[model samples]
Target chain A: MAEARRRILVVEDEYIIAVDLADALAESGIEVVGPVGNVARALAVIEAEPLDGAILDINLAGDAVYPVADALRARFIPFVFATGYDRSAIASGYETVPRCEKPVDGKRVADLLFRSIADR
Target chain B: MADDSPAAAPSPGSDELLRVVIESATDFAIFSMDPSGLVTGWNTGAERLLGYSETEMLGRSADAIFTPEDRVAGKAEEERRVATAEGRAIDERWQMRKNGDRFWASGLMMPLSAPGLGYVKILRDRTEQHHTEMRIRESEARFRLLATNIPQLVFRAQADGRRSWGSPQWIDFTGLSFEDSMGFGWLDAIHPEDRDATLAAWNDAAEIGEYYVEHRVRRATTGEYRWHQTRARPIQTGTDDRDVDWVGTMTDVHDLRELQGRQQILMAELQHRTRNLLAVTQAIAARTLRASASLDAFSTEFAGRLRALSRVQGLLARTDQGAIGLRELVWGEMEMHGDIEGRVTITGPTVTLTPTTAQTIGLALHELATNALKHGALAHDEGRLGIGWDVAATRPGYALVLDWCESGVALPHGRPRHAGYGSELIERALPYQLGAMTRLDFTADGVRCRITIPLRSANHG
Candidate 1:
């Protein structure tokens, strides 16, 4: 039997960017979970989904994405930050987390996510 | 040599030596006054100091040398009484000379019990020393006046930033008493986070000769913390560094610092927004290109979408707080297509939106109006478009419910372009971007779309 497609979740607020990111992830033959726009929905996905990594935007609407990040960390689910903020603005313990800074393409996001999560 | 003890009676040779010493002392006028205050003996020093020879001043009242004010105040008699009772009396006053000039005189009077020696007086001119003391008194009074009245909180500290004194303003602002503010007690009034840095600045001040730090200080009345610029400088007690005392002020700079901080935040926000806008614009272009049939179609669609995005960016930029009204967004979007003076009706309460909500929603309104102009109501002169919005109460808070109605036009006879970019934005992007609930209906007469944006979404900064 063919193995299940690798699943990845996207948490971004902007509409066009989210669609573009979702399309890019889908094109890579990866089963994309969501481009959930806020922290609450992102956390729901983290709790329900299994078996892969995630891409997170540092700012979800007006809320920090750290709670989602903390959830991901507690589950040992690997993730990378796609953010507009610099390292200093990120919460501590997340400064060292790999980041694909804002205005980056989906391929860069996907590649960084896979590289960080390949072992798991 | 054998009679060298000071308490012993003077030898004959020593008494002669004392007479010579007394007569030659030009600064001290040694003289004897009789019981009636008459001058009975005088020396050369007396003639030099008082500008009088023995012949001129002999038998004259010693009161003649006292200033008129001092004599009128009975200072001469008071000196005599004090000397008789106390064995020695010291008096300092402005005395008159034979030429009518004046000098400050510090005098000592002693009563001698030996015969013919009623009182012995020694006088020394101390005019320069008296002038110096007077100058110091006047300067000290001026310093007190300035320090107390100035708006800044004045303080005096040692070289190591130990508080020696604080002005009344300190007590009034920090609620710290004079005693409580002594030593490290004043540090309690400083914000704990700022104290370490403030102390560091003071520690450096000893070598740098100045102390300067900005910190939060607690206000006694409101118990609020306000930013204060604390500064001090060594008072320069001497050449030695350890003898230094510092005088400084703590000036309230909360408002000024807050303004500067807000300006910096605005600058950073502008930079972040510019970058985010560029990202959104890129996505719009990419999506438009994928939906277009050819390069020409892509150019037309992409340009329209960019214009919509740029217009909202303009609206957002002009506003200090990015507050875009619902009516203004709809009216401006409709007006961009053509003359919307009477053809469009927009009604709404004062509904404000954040920049992100306005940007995507502005584009959605642009697309709806564009479609109406191309195929719906505005395509015919008989067409009418009505747009209205109101903030309706929702479960948690309130949500803005906007209605767009296009009437007096026959519906498209063929299938609806459900897969197009405009439909995708209205049906999908609105919900994802603003967390809005939207319904687009293909009614027989025209198209009616209702967009409900929950105010609880990411619309706030």
Candidate 2:
């Protein structure tokens, strides 16, 4: 069977950071998903798309992205956190997941997402 | 019975004139007493002076005028003896008046030639003069009392610079005896550093008769230095430009001077810290803008990060060398995320961090947490996270290891179409600033990131 191309979702509040991350992942040969900036759009995209892994920013226009995290968890999908705050600032339940500090490195995101999907 | 044969009788006019002279005298009680001291005659002067009328006192004994104590001491007899042998006598003594009150009296008595006339006496009241003398004595006593009890060192010296007197208070304050404080011995208590200058000032003041001022003395009890303002003036002067004495006092003013010095040092330190903070803020702004693609995105993200930096700066301002509790740094960053309690997890031993390390770690942690909430595990309610760190001793130096992990979040469809600022900051900028190695793992179930920083880098930064 041919290896399936890994898919990722990027939900970030900063447009330039989100764009940079998407490009880095694509250059690494993995497919890119929506770089949604708001919680509502991010949720809609998550519900509609098929993804293997994801990268998330903890804040979206003064709102938390925990609801999106909750929906992704219910669907049994995995994601990585990318935030500008310390990991201690993240919710308790998501403590064991990996986190990438921003401004995000595109290559690191691609590498993390691919490894996460391959391991699963 | 009229005598017609032998001698010429005195004129009636001469006797009348003698009665008128005695009646007009008001200051003295002029009367005649017999050999045994019985009163034989009283004039209007005697009536007014003794508060007794001539009719009331004519038959009374003159000895009754002496006070009880004077009479007991034979003062009346003493006056009689002096008058009889010395021809006349004058004395000052206490005497009782008709009202039973006492008056100080100046009395004179003379022997008379008439057989029945033993002595003639005159008395003057001296109570007003006695009171005036008493007031002058009391004023001198009060001045002495004040000179003895004052806390400051006090001295009185002759115009020629010889110490005439020093208050007992001076001996107590200067740890010297009255004799020691009289002259040059008083200068021995002055601090060695200030002794020369103090002596010069004192000599100048004495020579020129000018007011002396100096802040150069040592405390007797503690042997500590203090500032003292000594002032003196010529109190009296006589003929030929001779000054009688000079009086002076010394007071302490050391603590006020020390407080002013400390205040100036603190002001300078504050100025230096403010300038350092401004430089750091400028660097952060320039970096954020350079990496941003557009003005809107740069402003939003830069402002947010700058606010985080400012919070760290506020904490640093309160510390002596820009150090703070590690826990405080963590909490401050979490609070910036707006209700991050339910969305964040932190685990570590409590520790203090230096200013530069705190800032570097703070910015790195901020970027990571922001990303996690926006796109990773914290994006959904059911998603979970874990964060922890540990310190270990290594060959080069101590090492700090931190991990962030997430689970229970679904992946997105297809792939992310655009690169963003968050990714570049976390993977590139963080390692560059911290001089550390970092790893990021994205999985089907969650994401994990680990960073290892050398102890030296952690401390210096």
Candidate 3:
């Protein structure tokens, strides 16, 4: 038996950042679930698909990604936050989640995602 | 012995003292009147103070020195009777001088009863003091009027930091009356968290004679805390260099404070956005560098991608509506190739797109147009291109379907040997970034691509 390609969701609103994130994840030999632009689409993807892990932008357009974080936590799924904001910008309870700042290194994020998923 | 009895030795003889007092007393007019209230004698002070001469005033009736109104009212007769019965009479009234001018006179008349002279009278001019007192009354009235009418809370305190007075406005605002706010009781009106600091500032001002501080105060109307700027200046009573009183004004600055707070947050947000934009630009440079084949290719492609991003950013900034129209995005990318009069056709209903969607689709359109000019359709003079879109109602949720078809030009020898960044962007980026289903193909006619995305997620403006 062979291991399945890990489907990881990417939630961000910035266009180039989203594309680059998807490309980075794909290059890491893991399947990408979404590069969802907002919270609603990210929630829809989470509901309709079985994701191994997820990477989230702290802000989607002008809305905070806390609702999506709450949902992911409720389901016991592992996730990391990718943001252009400081750690203080994240809401409480989600502070312990790993964060990768924007213009993140691809391999570093890949390792973070795998480690978070493995812990889960 | 003489030195030890200085008090008595310094006092001159009675006769000489009388002559000196009568001759040298310039501030007091000393005169004598006969029993019938007739002027018998006048001194130099009387001449100077009343503009009268002893020759002209002597033997004249003392009633002559009274104003006509007082004379008609029998005030002089009443003064003579009072002086005779009680031995002394003191009065303040307007009196006439020899020049017929009136002056404020504080006068005292006493019975001498030493045979020749029956009574002695002394008069002092008090006009300057009277005017000064009147002016002080008027000024105090004006200050009270202003303090009561204006919106600020006015207060007066002693040099020891004890409040002595508070205007009606203060009572109305803080629900503390003048007596209630006396001493340090006014501190109760300040917010608890700010009370100690406010007291400290006030104490500091006591030493410097200047009080200035901004802090939160409780409003009596709703019991809510609001910011106020309280300032005061010390009133120095004389040249003694000691503060006598403190006059202060507390202005309601809650709205201004809130505006300043919002401005700080806006400044911080602006900084965050600037950094994020730089990060985005850096990411584009890295991705463009990775995709280019050579230095020239990197420069051209990187500049083109940056231009695309900048154009979309311009549209977003101009609208400020946070969303861009789909028709505008399409035309912005295609108009660069020249007119679409006969060579290209764009047909789509006006639809607005979120900034994120506009940016992603904008880059995708740039790739498609670049490909059309390089290899497939626009590369030939006779090629034709048609781009159209429609809202599909097939599924429970609607979908936006867009089609790109190039005709009138021969296709390539089959599929190309390798797929470049252009194909990967159209086929892979659309699905991965936008959750859209995309198809790209090369037929014998030209290149064609179709895209479908859930309207709920993709078409929301």
Candidate 4:
């Protein structure tokens, strides 16, 4: 039996940021599941698809992605939050989640996500 | 030897000396009244002090010299009766002058040992002294009132920096009684961390007759140490060593200090946000260049993206509350392309976006609309586009699902083989940024897209 490609869901709202992140993930030889624009699609994909891990934008089209974060947490799926804001903007319970500030390097984010999942 | 006879009285030369001495007296109004209280004699002193000469007053009733109220109350008659019974009477009361002005008179009535003459009256003016005393009392009362009622913590200290007085406000603010704050005891109300510095400043100020310092004082009500600016100036005495006292006030400045601190933090945050925006702009330019085949194409696309960003910024600025409505964001992009009234049909309840979300979504909408105008259904006059969104009934929380459809135009053969930034934005960026599951399909008829993403929370618009 052959192992499946590791599919990572990408949750971001900005077009440019999402494209850059997807390109970085593709360059890393990782199968990208989504470049979702909001929390609804992110959670839907998370439930319908078998995710290896996830890359999340802390805010989604004017909405906070905490619901998606909480869902990923419930599933024991490791993820990294990509944000334009600082760490203080993150709620208390999600402190341990890794944060990557804006103008994010996709390769760095991918590495962090993989490492976090591996650690898990 | 008994000297009871008139022939035994005084010699003619001695009588002349007596008249000259009495007339020369300017302070006392030497005048004599008969048994009936009639003016019998008046001297130059009487004329100067009462504004009346002997010619005008000698035959007048002496009762005219008393104030009307005193005369009405029988004070003049009472004085005569007292003088006749006791052989003398003295009083300090208001006496009328010839000009109708009143003077405080120190007067005496005495009986003379002469036949048919009852008494002689002596009057002196004391008006200036009485007015001076009253003025001093009024000034003292005003000072007492201001010291007690003012809001600032007022204080008075001796030349040597020994505090002599503190306003009631000090007691109210620091819960220290006047007795406790007097002298050096008031130092205890100051913050312990500020005590040494305050004392040093106080000593310095004592020499210069100016006291000014800012330090913390413990507030009694909250037991919190709050900042206060204290200032005092020397009560200037004419002589250098006679600088007798310092009056000072302490004003609360803790709120202003805290506001200044907050302003610094906000400034830093603004700097950070500006840096992030610049980086994002750089990335947009780089990606647009890579995705374009020619400089003109790159310029046009880049300019369009920048405009998209600026439009969102304008909207955010106008709203001022930091949240932008999703309907407004979508309409803004479509409207910029030209008249969107008939061609674009949008349906959604209401959705307000955060600053980050609105900007990102606004750019995505711009890219979508631009592509439609260039190669999609919107390129044709009869073509139509419909956009709508709704919250998905998802477990744990609601999610957003949006649909875009176009009609009245022939579609392409199939989905484009190479994914450009716009396609990538729709297919990959949506999922990455918003965790959205999106589908972009090009059919023989038109292009359609469906996006489903999780809402932030159930209550959010």
Candidate 5:
């Protein structure tokens, strides 16, 4: 039997972006987890689910996703941010993490997250 | 002392008519004195005006009516000596009455015969008029003190824009002298653009009884135009309402306008909204590409979605409350296709959504209705579509519960859940953006979606 595929969580507040991103990840032969939309739900999923990596949109609706980003960091999981905001919006501790500015493509987000995980 | 009786008006028997006229001339105190300045003659007018009768005044010195200070200063003797040489000496001064009350007396003395001789005199009391003039002088001094010391620039003007005077504060603030500020010269210190409006307000003051205007006035030190509020009120002159004069003041309000500060903030906000909108357009195009079978199909679907986005942006732009109503969002998408007068029913308790939430939900609604028109309930005449929403309590807070259902249609086989854009937005976007709880059921009859989204004014992160 083949080894289990990596389960990557997609945390994006925009529905179309999340669906497209989630579909793109699935097309690449990886097991995709939730594309949770809010900070609280994303935190819950991060706490309970088994994940290889995650992608985040810095703003979920109007609330910043820093708390969710903090949770992923606490668990030692690697993730990349997709944001309409500039790089300065991210917390200083997570400054070194990759950022893919919106109008962002899924492949770039995936590559950045997996690369971040491998480096760690 | 009794040399000449010519100072008396006349004997009663010789000029009875003249004597009666003199006696009854109650406004004047007609009396005479001999060359020695003693009281030699008296009349009833003198008695009434001076509070003295002929019996009490006879043989008394004419100087008896002089005030103590005037007598001490020899004013009575000097007047008599001047009258002897000049034919008449006129003086108005404080004189005493018999009861010790003081009256302001206007008196004239001339020589009874020649210089260094006794003199005749005439007197009139003007005490009430003098008191009134003194009161006016005192109030004017008090007003001058207040106007100069206040921080605001004060002025006196006619109903026209012509100013009669400006306070010391006005002169100091505008660097304009009393000469330069007179008439319409004060307009030179106001901003050119604001002068016309200020003058117009001033012109209307006659009918309105007041002048009020907000304009820019130049500060003399900095030579900069600053915002100032000027107000003037008419002071009516008693019964006739004529002889009106205006009292006005100008107060600086430069900091309150804050025009530049607000413009900078709006610039930043505009940039942010623009960037976010572009990102949204990119997302729509990408998804439309995924769901289409051909380039032509992609173009049509993508265009429709873009129009939906534009409509929502239009709604967002016009909303003064920074929110869009739920009913507007739904009908906005539905009406874009055509009127859903009979085919679709929408009911909801009015609720508002934030810009971010409205944008996301608007896309979801577009896809839902579009899908129905193309392949679902809206495609069949027998099908029915119902949309309803109401507020309900949830764990964290209250939320808007919305139901979208289509009946009298069969779910097409081989169409997998979450395989298309409509289902994706409904199932994923709503939950992501609003923390919404949603359910989409593809049953034996038709498609149904229920969503619960929390209600709150949006907060910008």
Candidate 6:
């Protein structure tokens, strides 16, 4: 059986970081979705697209991305958190989601995204 | 007409009676002066006070006893003119005596006119009373100086709350002049928020004739409000059944009040830090104890871990309570093994780790790096380790990925039958505290451990 190409969404505010992550994922042969930087655009992409999984930045322009986390949860799309802050700074409800700290390795990005999609 | 009057009776007995009366008086100086202002009669009072006997003064001109300046200014002529025109003249002035010394005197000159003779004048002296009045005036001047120089805003007010006298100190302290500090002007200097209560307190005290004390005033320099204690009380008896004057003072106590506020905040911060430290220590102890087989083993392991913690804490203290750079902390832990010159390569952009995160990660990294040095890859000089991390994009969170990769060490025969303290702590304890997913891989060539800590638990330094 041929390996299925996983669809992943990247939500990051910083322009360079978002581009780096998308390029890294695409190089790993995974299909990259919208690398949206704001909450409204991220939510619209999630609703319009067929996303298998996602990577989310904890802060977007000084506001939290919990609403995106909530929408992903409702859609049963597994997502991982990427942050510079420690775990204590995250809200209590989202504690169980997988998290990766920067600077992320290209291979680990492939592995974690593949695992999150396969688990879903 | 002269023979009909008692003065012209020419009785030797009447003359003796008059002499007896004049000589016996102590408080009054009775003397007679002729129309030319000469001393024609003198009594015992004049003899004792003026230091002149009645016989010596009887023929002398009264002008001889006046001060040189008063004589030059025609004071004697002025007195005589008033006496002749107004029948009697009263003057309070400096007078000279037989010794040419001056005394403040209240003198009265009365003109005595008979039917056929020239006018006779009666003079009375008042030097003693004048001295008492001078002393009283001096005392009042001293009191005024004291009130003006006090550090507080000293003031005097009438019974109706009208300010009568405000000290110069008020101008010095409030930068307001005497006129500006009176009545409602004083209330204007008070902070608007505190003005009503301060006025009410003053009014109540004034109505009941009690001491008024209030703490509400504005600072002179900044126009910022400050606490002041203003106190006032009636200067005289309140029960005198008359209008009373009140004397008061105001003192600045803002510094004392501010010190008390700072002390309270410091006390609260101390309490919070104590509780947080206790919680962190308890967590460390519980995790260490649970991972040990025996108390002896636990003690040794815990001691080593605490020593590592203390080393990191010392480094942080040197930085003056600021975040320690991640690269520095990692390099510091590795250098403790004595020789890591070519074996370990740490790379990353400068990331500042919070103190709590630094200690946790410092200990975790210390244990892993120690294990690798002792048995895994870094034990061999040919081995190389790459330690690096960067931020990743994840929804509503950040991912920090740290890698420990080793090369050129001989492979372990198989994964160890039992996981050791270092393995369990890196895989379990760190994830629990840091909310990161940790992975440990044992390969034929070297060991690799990766930790992805969430930003929430790991961002602050």
Candidate 2 Cα RMSD (Å):
22.0
In candidate 2 chain A, what residue range of length 10 has the lowest lDDT sum? A12-21
Least accurate stretch of 10 residues (summed lDDT) in model 4 chain A?
Answer: A12-21
Q: Estimate each model's TM-score.
A: 0.76, 0.46, 0.70, 0.57, 0.48, 0.56
Which should have the higher lDDT, number 1 or number 4? 1
Candidate 4 local lDDT, B1-461, one digit each (tens): 66788888876698799888888887889888788877889988889888888988877888888889999999999998888888889998999988999999888888877746867778888787767666756765676688788778888887555788889899899999999998888998999999888888878896776888899999999999999999888764323456466888999999999998798666655644554565568778878887789999999999999999888888888886777888888888888888777888999988777677677667777777887898886898989999998877787588778788888877668877775667777776666665668888887777788887777783356
DockQ: the better of candidates 1 and 3: 1
Error of 4 at B36 (Å): 28
lDDT of 3 at B379: 86
Which pairs clash in the backbone of model 3? none
lDDT of 6 by residue, A1-120 (tens): 187877889987644356566767887887888777778888999999998888987766556899999999999999998765456557799988887765555458668766877776
Please state the error at residue B420 of candidate 5 in Å.
3.3
> How close to the true structure is residue B17 of candidate 3, measured as C-alpha lDDT?
86
**Clashing residue pairs for model 1:** none
Top-lDDT structure, candidate number: 1
Question: Which regions of candidate 2 deviate over 4 angstroms?
Answer: A1-120, B1-169, B195-216, B219-223, B226-310, B313-323, B339-343, B354-387, B394-461
How is the predicted docking of candidate 5 categorized under the CAPRI scheme? acceptable
User: Which runs in model 4 stand beyond 4 Å of their true positions?
Assistant: A1-120, B1-145, B158-162, B193-197, B200-213, B237-244, B258-271, B458-461
DockQ of each: 0.57, 0.01, 0.28, 0.19, 0.25, 0.02
Question: TM-score (0 to 1) for chain A, all models?
Answer: 0.92, 0.91, 0.94, 0.93, 0.91, 0.93
| TM match of model 5 to true structure | 0.48
Find the 10 residues in a row with the least total lDDT in model 3 chain B: B235-244
Query: Residue B6 of candidate 1: its Cα lDDT?
Result: 75
Compose the digit string of candidate 1's lDDT tens values, residues B57-102: 8898989888889899998999988888899999888998898889
Q: DockQ of candidate 4?
A: 0.19
- Candidate 1's fnat? 0.57
